[model samples]
Target: MIDSFLTSYKIILASNSPRRKQFLTDLKIPFEVKTANIDEVYPDHLVKGEITDYLAKLKAAPLEKDLKDNQILITSDTIVWHNDTALGKPVNEAEAFSMLSNLSGTNHQVISSVCLTTKKQQLVESVTTEVTFKDLTPEEINYYIANYQPFDKAGAYGIQEWIGYIGITSIAGSYNNVVGLPTAKFYELLKKLV
Candidate 1:
C-alpha cells in the first residue's frame, strides 16, 4: 500500500480544505492538518498552472522551515481557468452565479498544484483537467448557489456536488485534480521522495 512508502516520515497537510483532507484519508496517507494565512494574490503575469504552482509553493513558505527531517509538508492550490482567466473562490452569491454562468456549456481547465517539502528537498507539480458543463439555466444556477454555497470553491462549483451531477457533461483528466488534488500524479511524485 502507499502508506508503506511514507513510513519513514510524518505527514503534514497545510490546507483547510475538507475535500483535500478527505483525499489524503481516502489514500490512507496519514497526515495532520495545519494551516497559515497568506494573501492568495499572485502576479498579474502568471498564467494557468504557473499561478497554482506559485501559490502551492507560497503556501509552504511558512511551514517548510519548521519541518523536521522526518516530516513532509504538503501544500496545494486549485483554480478554474476559463477563457484565459483564472477563476478563484467567489466572495458572494452574485459572483458565484457569474462564474458558473460563464462556464455554462463551455469547457474549462481546472488546474491544481501540489508541493511536497522535506527539510532537505522540495517537489512541486501541477495537473490540469478539462471539464465541460451543460448549458445551465438561471434557475439551476440559482438553486446550486443557494443550496451548495460554493463560494469557497473555485469556479463556484464542486465536481462532487449536485451541480456536478446535473451540469458536468464530460471530464478529460484526473477528477481528483478538479476536486482539488491529483492523487495518482501525486502518488507518483511521492515515490521520488521514497
Candidate 2:
C-alpha cells in the first residue's frame, strides 16, 4: 500500500471534517489531523473554483509554515454555487430552508479545492461537480432541516444524507466533491507529490 511508498514522509491533514478524514482513510493514505480556526473569507471578485482554491490554501497557510521537510499538509474547502451566488454553511434553520428552496429544481455547482503543502513545494487544485435537484416542496425542505440539521453543510444540505437520496435528481461529476472532498482528483494530486 501507499504506507510503504510514503514511509519517508508523514502526512498531516488540517481539517476536522469527518468526511475529509474518511476520504484519506478510504484512500489508505496514512496522515495525522491538525486544525486551526481560519477566517474563510475570500475576495468578492473571486468566483467558484477560485474562491475554493483561495480558501483551501488560506486554511493551509498557518499550518504550513512550520511543517518539517518530512511532513505534507493537506487542506481543502468546499462551497455550493448557484445562480452566480455562493451558498456557504447556513447560520440557522430559516437560512437552511431558504438555501434549499432556491436549489430546488435547479442546477448548481459543487466546487471543492484541495491544497497540499510541504516545506519545499506546494500544490493546489480543484474539482467542480454539477448537481440537479428535483422540485422540492416546502414540506420536504422543512423536514430535512428539522431532522437532519444541515446547518453545517453548504447549500444547506448533505448530498449523502436523506436529501441526496430523495431530492437530488442527477449529478454530472464526482459525488465525493459534493460530499466534502474530491477523492479521485485528490489522489491524482497526491501522486504528483511522490
Candidate 3:
C-alpha cells in the first residue's frame, strides 16, 4: 500500500534507531538508512515538544543541503517528559535506574517529533503519548536494567520490552509513539506529500 504512495520519492531515514527502521519496513515503505552525527543540545528555555522538535530538525539540517530532488529525508527524536523535566537517553546504568525510578508510579509524556526535508520544502511535526506506570519494585527495576540495559532509550524503558509488558499499567496515546516513532501521524503526513 505504501509502495504505491511512496514510489515517486526516494525515502531516506536519518536515524540509527532499529525501531524506526522496523516501523518503516513494516509500513512497506522502501527506505535507506543514513545517520548524521549532530550535537542534540537545545536552548534551556525550550520545553517538552520544543526540545524534540529542535533536535529532530537539527538531525535533518545537514542532510537538507545534500538531498536530491527525489530524496525525502526523515529524522526524529523522542523524549520522556515528567514533572516539567525532559528525560533523554541515559548516559549510564545508574542514570537509567534513576530515570526509571523517577517514572515509577507516575504519569509521564512521551513526545516524539519528526522532521521531513525534501528539496523544496521542510516540515516538522510531533506527537505526545501519556504513559502511566504502576509502582515498580526495586527488584523489578534492577532486573530489567540488568537484562534489558535500556540506556539507549529515553525514560530508560521500551514499551514493547519486558518492563512494559509487566510494569506499565496503562497508556493514553499511540503505543508506537512511545517506541520512538508515531506511525499513524507519520503515515498521514506522507500521504499528504505523495
Predicted structure with the largest lDDT when compared to the true one: 1
Question: Clashes per prediction?
Answer: 0, 0, 0
Model 2 Cα lDDT, one tens digit per residue, 1-194: 45565898899999988899998888878889999998989999999999999999999989988999889999999999999999999999989989999999999999999999999888999999999999999999999999999887889999999999999999999999999999988888877887
Off by over 4 Å in 2: none
Estimate every model's Cα lDDT from 0 to 1: 0.94, 0.92, 0.92
Compute the lDDT of residue 65 as modeled in candidate 2.
83
For candidate 1, lDDT tens digit of each residue in 1-194? 55676788899999989999999999888999888999999999999999999999999999888999899899999999999999999999999999999999999999999999999999999999999999999999999999999988999999999999999999999999999999987888788898
lDDT, candidate 3, residue 37?
88
Residues 99-134, candidate 3: write the lDDT tens digits. Answer: 999999999999999888898888889999999999
Least lDDT summed over 10 consecutive residues: which range in candidate 3? 1-10
Candidate 1: list runs displaced more than 4 Å: none
TM-score of 1: 0.98
Error of 3 at 167 (Å): 0.8
TM-score of each: 0.98, 0.97, 0.97
> Alpha carbon lDDT of residue 27, candidate 3?
85
